[model samples]
Target: MADTHENAYDEFAEAYAAMNETGSWNAHYERPATLALAGEVAGLRVLDAGCGPGILTQELTRRGATVTGVDASEQMLGLARRRLGGSATFARADLGKPLPFADASFDLVTASLVMHYIEDWSVPLGEFRRVLTRDGRLVFSTHHPTMDFHISGADDYFATYQFDDEWFHGDIVMKMRFWHRPLRAMTRALGEAGFGIDVIDEPDPEESVRESEPRAWESLSTKPAFLFFRAFPRYSA
Candidate 1:
């Protein structure tokens, strides 16, 4: 059987990709925030982990990063390959397992709204650290714990657990699962994986969305929809 973590994306790859292309939450909110955190990537070796549909990968490559995009869903990878067309390399790999890259293989690693799917951060995070150069950084975004707890209606904030939810894109609806852990737990996991946190951002929706997506702008501006982190490897002396 396929890993339950990845099956949902394969089922709605096309629909989700279409929606993500113009969706206010993705285009104006998460993607912009993530790219801002990445700063200048020209000439950097970037690994776009969980690079669904090549949306972020295309932008990274355009900004002069030699990117390698990886996703667990073949359907999504196919979409990515078609979208980029030899501009960047593509791979099929799961963040839940050891990444298929050599140590110090990349200058930056980016995971956009992908980490929440994995219940255990140890293996994936360690893999991120292992693949990144000494000076490299990992930039990622995920569903904010508080928001997820509210959406999940879970009683325990400190405990780590998976919750199921459904996503609607146009007329297509897909069920997905995500793991939720408290703020402390998230930071602790990163520290245990040898990453030193540099920035923890709770971004507001871009002003551009104010007129076009007023509701999204209002909600995201006032509440924490997602959390972003920029972390670097910390080696012991």
Candidate 2:
């Protein structure tokens, strides 16, 4: 499944970034959430898992972290390398497989807008816990289930609930997954993966973005844009 998505991303690399730049897709969707969870990256050894095009990776570097970015798409990594220059390290990796790094290797791990594409979050979550230092943190953001309910297919928000049980975004040609689980499911998964939940935020879309973008405000304020979380590797029994 990850490979299928990687192949799709390889084909969409140019268009993906262009769409993001032109607002065909919302670039800011995950930015504020990721930054809020990261706090300060200064001097940290950061692992940017599923770092498509390195947008957040570059941001991490700017904040003084020594960052290494990994993604499945060679084309995406190519773009990341070009944009990031010598500022960070880049690697080609598939998230479905074991991450190719030693245990207790990183100060922090970040996965932004990437978890949804994965079928089993536990596999990589466990791997992330394994690679992180005892005190290290993992932060990530994913689609909100309610938002998924609202946007499934109906043009009107009120009309969408009839189609609730279906995989709302399943038919989306682009490779994506939607986890509409309640908060308890997420906390349980993290606990099963050896992580302790530190923070879970459902940010109000209006407040998250700069106030000048009225269109962004209107569209997002009506719905939750994302669910972000910060988790730490459990230190003791």
Give the candidate number with the greatest lDDT: 1
Cα lDDT of all candidates, in order?
0.92, 0.75
**Once superposed on the true structure, which residue ranges of model 1 sit more than 4 Å away at CA?**
1-6
Segments of candidate 2 deviating more than 4 angstroms: 1-6, 21-29, 153-182, 206-212
lDDT by residue (tens digit), candidate 1, 99-173: 879999999999998889887889889999999999999999999999999989999999998888888876777
Model 1 lDDT-worst window of ten: 1-10
Candidate 2: clashing pairs of residues: none
How much is the lDDT of residue 127 in candidate 1?
Answer: 97
TM-score top scorer: 1
Per-candidate TM-score against the hidden true structure: 0.97, 0.82
